[model samples]
Target chain A: MEVAEKTWGLMKKKVLVIEDNADHQAIIKSSLVSRNYLVVCADNPSDALHYLLDEKIDLIILDLWLPEMDGLSFLKDLKNVPEFSEIPVIVTSGTFGSEYDILKLNGYGVREFFMKPYDPAELVETVGSLLKKTVD
Target chain B: MFYYTDPKRGRDMKRQKRVFLIGLLAAILGYLWELYLIHSHPPFIFVKIKPTWWMQWVILFAAWRIGVFISGLWKTQPTASSQKENDREEELKYLSRIYQDLSNSLRLEKGKFEAVLRGAPDGIFTLDEVGRINFWNESMEKLTELKKEDVLGKPYEDVLTFYSTGKLVGFEQGTMEGSSSSEPRQAVNFFSFNGDQSLSFLEIDAEVSGGKEFPAAVSVSTLKSPDKKNTEQIIITVKDMTAQKEIEKLREEMIAMITHDLRSPLSSILGYAGLLQNPKLCVSEEDRQKFLTALIRSGKGMLLLINNLLETARLGDGKVPVISEPVKIKMVLEEVAENLLALAKGKNLSLSVEAKDNLWADSDKDKLHEILTNLVSNAIKFSRSGEAVKITAFEKAQEVVISISDSGPGIRAEEKEYLFEKFSKIKKQGSTTGLGLYIVKKLTDKINGRIVVESQEAIGSTFTLKLPASKKASSSVQLSLVGSR
Candidate 1:
């Protein structure tokens, strides 16, 4: 799952990936960080909440399943805190079905939903496009 | 001369016969007396027939005296003393009837007792207070392979001698291990009886015909007299418990097999998953594919093993229940919170819950309960002294989020590779089967929800689940007070 479309614009984009699986987290970080996009990681949402406060996070990548709190609920909880609502969350999960559509998640204030064993390239491209829009 | 028989017929016949003889004598007496009177002193003057006539007079006088005795006897009735004699005989008959009834019931009871003992399926025998084998049942005869005639009425230990480890069963030489079982360890030894635990071996008259030994559960009980007045006998019942012992052995064998089989596959999956998750390893695409394929295969194998060890239904049935009802999410969380508080307190941990007043989730109550319970229990398992575990839930836009946070030795970032994988071990987790998290994940997937983990080393960990909130229960639905009841 590597991205063929690598960005040439050398701007440091800071992102926090709230994920529990180390391998998937490693794969996501490796695929994104190599392209000059700095990734901050938290194993759960509560820690994700910390990085949101401490850093200038451009975007957030959240795993749907986590130990401390689920991604959607954390999204909902994060939305209640006015400042975190401005941050767009890219939800990634190992689970799928009709109930897990990206549009359906958008209704929960999620910007995107990625199914795992996901293509790391597509994720990077999607992150690039969203970050570009926010920067503009 | 006639006998006066008991019946009145014999007495009348004898009386009539004697009267007829008397009548004949009277006629002769009338004529003879006239002649004798003429001879003695003539009616007008002395008419002498001679001195021989004197003998005739003596015979006549003797007949008259016997007749007077018979007449007197005919006038008397049965005496009062004789009536008393009849009454005495009636009393004797009534006494005999009562004696018959008492003796008959006693005999019947004795017959029943003997029959029960004789027909018993298990070996049974009775010993007198002195330990003499007075009674032996049919089963005992069959068990010993000796006829009742041979063993009964003889000293039990001598007649039906059995040796276990070359020591007598009832009279063990010195309570040796291999010898006959020890005497009752309970208070029964204080009395003459042996408690049911005193088991022994009974070999057929092994001296005469060598026979295999069968273990017998022996119960020696004191038999009371029929009136329950006194104890004079001891009865022993022996049941062959060989089948029960065999079943117990089989169960131990099954447990051994489960441990050996389940552990190997678990470690196999853990090792393979660990290897596959390494991102920096330089390898050919084919090799990576091979390892990935092996990892999946081994992972399935581990799942099959665990599925067999525990209930296999949890995986299959978990996905099928779409029972979408507006369940009060706070009620379940509160119930789980109250229940696990004691467990947390046992380790000096504080467990608390925070939830909105009437938040509801569109989900199956049972599945959600299982999911919540597994998460909460896992929290307590990894927690230690003075750690506080918190459960918080709230409805966020279109979904309700529940979180169980535990101040425990949290997972390392590296080991998180397979945190929720089936049979994966967590840091500092002692020997648990590790099926809890895997099941929890599956249940979350089934309910169309998702779980997330947040942890830091030495800080703590929290597991949160986001389930869709039921629109029908929008707001203002009050869940009944659920905890501290």
Candidate 2:
């Protein structure tokens, strides 16, 4: 009776994907959706920021190379805002970045980094762990 | 002649003649004055001696000797002057011979240079500093299909008269309309480099004769004067790299296709494995078999792709040997038809074979099977639903011909040239790698066979392969005919 009350009351958290590739976005969407996590997609940082403003986003999955703005700038701007600062961002890139860029992104409170073609299973586990930490 | 023609030398000769005349005139005047003075005033009678008969004889002898001495002086003056003139003429003749020799050697050297330039297989054109075509060779003539008279003095940037407005034609200008693999315009930038610059090479896909654009590797080297001090001309060597570039592009495209093709099957295999690994999922024995079967089909598709790739690599080195033994062509066609039945059924295609009894040819058994399989498979892949593909084999003289006819949309007339070329992609929707016909052509060459394709758009295509008949098969057939008679 207690489990039913808790499950029915709280809705699934929304995760926004900032990816440009159609196949990668589809794969991310299907994987997350199959795991019962609400997913949203955007091709760039600016559109993803709009999602963060309109919807109650629990976490952000970011890609570095974007049309309008990059993931680093988005992270910097999001952190400056008092309301969106708490949401953790995960950086995923097709291009393997240098050590300095990874260290710098980590200092920005990024939860984790994944290089593409990443294992979909590991991605799910990481997302689950980060969300669990956020709830706690 | 030179002394007369030259004003300076003529003036000296005239001055010398005038001096000689004045000396002669003075001597005559002095002689006449002496005669007049002696006649007017006679010498003292005591000092003057009267002439006798013996005195007359001595005077005569002295006169004769003096005459001889004067004649000798005259002869020496004339002979010395004539000798000097003769020496001058000989010197002039020697100089003229040297001049002739130098000119002949220069002409021979020029001929040798011209021959070397024209002998080059690549287009060699020497451009002046101002971009004028100072020298054009025979290869350039062939490459541009422009005659020497037309292009020798023309400018590098030509304005074609084809367009009424006189559109300018530049070599290998860059635009985004080219293929995705097009490089930046750095190669042609060598032409625009500043004065007396270091040598550079610029390769481009130039539109040559007949508006056909082919890739060419151009190297620009500055031709300096004989002393190597000043830049004389720019020598541009244009090597037509069309064939090499085509192979490279095909290789890249094939790689991309292989990656994409491999990914689809890999995705299926991964999905199946993921499902099987799931502890929450339950599977039936029948479902397992179906999954296994799907995996096997995907694996076979990958295997066929790998096989085609291996064949391409093998054929690239040299021709593989063919076993010249008697083999029945009918069996090969039947085998190909049997294999393509499932594929034809999927597309609802009618596949049929017409062959003479035991129609044999001297060819490799396995290679013949492979050739039939490729042709029949291609036919089925291209044919629409309910359309029929026919395989027919016959014998004419010492050759055996097997023709595969398809009801697919046939190849266009223009596309036939590239049909057997490596990496040629005529159809967009091909299941196999695009090197099918190229490999078939190579294999046919191994058995000294010939292959030809006859097609009309919307009508269909017929591919024919002809190989020499084995002697044994012909002799056996002749023996059977005699026995029947």
Candidate 3:
């Protein structure tokens, strides 16, 4: 039974959500937690960096507008780090995503882009599929 | 040549001829008298006068010559005086002709200069050496609503007041009493302080007639005398910044609405509502309740933002109606506090109100409630957990005074000037629209009340609102609802 629990723990994927809005953080956490994934939340980029340094995060959910630094700058900082560069990121924004923003995110190897007012079910499915692809 | 053509010289020649004729007649009469004496004179008179006919003829000829010489001397004397008078007349005529030509050219040049100033889009005026408005252009007239005849020779400070960065500028003290040296010095100081060069545009606030104020870009140039040491005149050019300011405000508002205000709340609402709807996800009853509450909160926030936007537009168009009536100050304060209770609780702040007994104000209840709600909510938003937001009301000198105080990170002194300006967010965080205080100020002004803010950095802020007290004497005093469509 100990070996089985260990295997189960190793199989679960961890997601770090960097969002300022409490409601968005809670909803995303609930959705991911129900699917048996580990979720860590940070409300700012500094805390997000601390979380990234402390743990082996498999995926990242980033909100664009943040308290200390914006998500794009944080993402660039993350990409520069060899340890966290391999983690896939899905960007969500409150602004209407322009084509230029999408292209820029794609250039940064963003896994997905979601404008606000997005459906939570769709987001969960995308998260699942992106995580599975990373595993593959 | 002038002497020959002169009418006065011709009159002198005629007078000279008359004198010669008179002399000749007198000489002929004397000659006839001699002849009579020679022919039939008394024997004794003939013996004393002449001896022979030859001697008598010689005397007659000599007398005629002497009379002609005397006539010549008289004519020359008159001619000298007449020649001086004629030369003076010619000199005066020539000078007058030159003067006419110079004045005509000067008038043409003046017309062109005036036309250029009048047709210019900018407001242009000139201050003379004595600090009076000597020239005011058409644009200046249109801008200030003061005619040239009215403002000409008036002191510039009395006609228009200019402010640079919220401080009065562009005029020195004692300018109205004709203190000449100080005005040019102040103008030069104002320009040189703004730029390295003497001429540069300075953004200023111009207050015109009827106490109306607008943003203006003013450029100052001194018209120097030939020596360049003293400033002869100060030329000011003003461009209206109202249109540019409006465009900039609209752009900022659109960006804030699209990026933050409208979308942030909508994002929360959608995310929370979607989570609640997804049955496949095991949301417990408690989680469900939390999600529902968040949804309601976001919806209410969005509704408030939309209403504030509509109110701003209506207020801009002057379409909002004001129906002033007696309202109990304490009751309105309680209603606003109740409306914002949840917001305060969410932030872990306590809301309190203090008012005198039977405190009443002459105001519109709905507007008063909105103003109080905005102020109280702003207080709660800025405060830390466990801090108290206080609302106090009292009667003082026939007026109802209400103040909202919060122990938040108080606004910096520099940020206070634009605190009530549209979209002037000192701290850009969260879902603040930055329109709350602006709307509150507008509403207060619309209802004929005054709002004042006092704050210190890291201490707190208090917004005091004053309104007329409810009294029978003031019941007949009606508010001029000119803004209502």
- The TM-score leader among the candidates is 3
Clashing pairs in 3: none
Interface RMSD of 2: 7.6
Candidates ranked by DockQ: 3, 2, 1
- The DockQ of each candidate is 0.02, 0.04, 0.46
Give lDDT: candidate 2, residue B70: 45
DockQ, structure candidate 1: 0.02
| Model 2 lDDT per residue over B398-475, tens place | 889889898788988998999888767565332445667887888888878999999988889999999997664432
> Which candidate ranks first by lDDT, i.e. highest?
3
Per-candidate TM vs. native?
A: 0.31, 0.48, 0.59
lDDT digits (tens) for residues B1-485 of candidate 1: 33233364444544555555564566477557656665564443444544356656665655555554454365445468756875786699789998999899989999998898899998888888677878888887777787888877886656543323443445424443332343322111112333322543433212213544555555556766677655568777766656766666655544443453354334434434544454533344655565465455445444544643453245746435557888888788877766665546545677777777678889988778878877886787688667777788888878899998988889899867787766554435322345567777887888899999998988888898999998745445343333221
Candidate 2 residues lying further than 4 Å off, grouped into runs, are A1-136, B1-95, B115-133, B136-200, B204-216, B223-232, B238-247, B254-288, B312-319, B324-364, B383-422, B428-430, B437-485
In order, the interface RMSDs are 9.8, 7.6, 1.8
lDDT of 3 by residue, B376-449 (tens): 87898788778888888877789888999998888888888999987775653466767889899999998899
Q: Give the true-structure RMSD of model 1.
A: 25.2
| Span of 10 residues, lowest total lDDT, candidate 1 chain B | B183-192
